[model samples]
Target: MPEWMRSFGRAEDGAVTVDWVVLTAAVVSLGMLAGVAIWGKTGGAAKGIADYIGTQGVDTTPM
Candidate 1:
């Protein structure tokens, strides 16, 4: 109803800040997703290696 309130409502100065915030959040989310994928695969590979070694046994044991 007030002129000042209407002007404030139409302001564009903070729009860029909002866009940057949203973009930053999206980028961080993608990075986290990639990190989780890599971490999960690495863990699985390590577990597989351990299982193989356990089943095959070490070729030699040190003195």
Candidate 2:
């Protein structure tokens, strides 16, 4: 084989960039999933809080 072909086969330094890209993509996907889950819960939580406040017998009418 030629010297250049042997050199290409022996090189290992470029793999780190690929590994970092994959890791970053995985982290971003997980973050988006977490945001979706949290968003789904937010409305329910707000409703619960409002219900609790309403049950306290305070007048809900605006001043």
Candidate 3:
């Protein structure tokens, strides 16, 4: 009801800061979700590669 309170409510000085914080949070959340989705496949692929490498024999022939 007061003039000062009304002016404060209408102020836009901190709007950009609030927008940036929200945007940053959304980006970080999306990145974490993407990483979690890929992590399972990554681990499986890494294990398969390691198993394949472990089966190969090292040749020690001297020139």
lDDT per prediction? Answer: 0.95, 0.94, 0.97
Ranking by TM-score: 3, 1, 2
Query: Which regions of candidate 1 fall more than 4 Å away from where they truly are?
Result: 53-63
Return the TM-score for each candidate structure: 0.72, 0.56, 0.77
Q: Write the per-residue lDDT of candidate 1 for residues 1-63, one digit (tens) a residue.
A: 999999999999889999999999999999999999999999999999998888985658688
Q: How many clashes in candidate 1?
A: 0
- Scored by lDDT, the top model is 3
lDDT order, best first, reads 3, 1, 2
- Model 3 TM-score is 0.77
- Highest TM-score: give the candidate number: 3
Compare candidates 1 and 3 on lDDT and give the better one.
3
Residue-level lDDT tens digits of model 2 in 1-63: 999999999999889998999999999999999999999999899999999998887578998
Each prediction's total of clashing residue pairs, residues at least 3 apart in sequence or on different chains, is 0, 0, 0
lDDT comparison, 2 vs 3, better candidate: 3
Candidates 2 and 3: which is better by TM-score? Answer: 3
Q: Cα deviation in Å at residue 22, candidate 3?
A: 0.3
**C-alpha lDDT (0 to 100) for residue 6 of candidate 3:** 96
Candidate 3 Cα errors over 4 Å, as ranges: 1-3
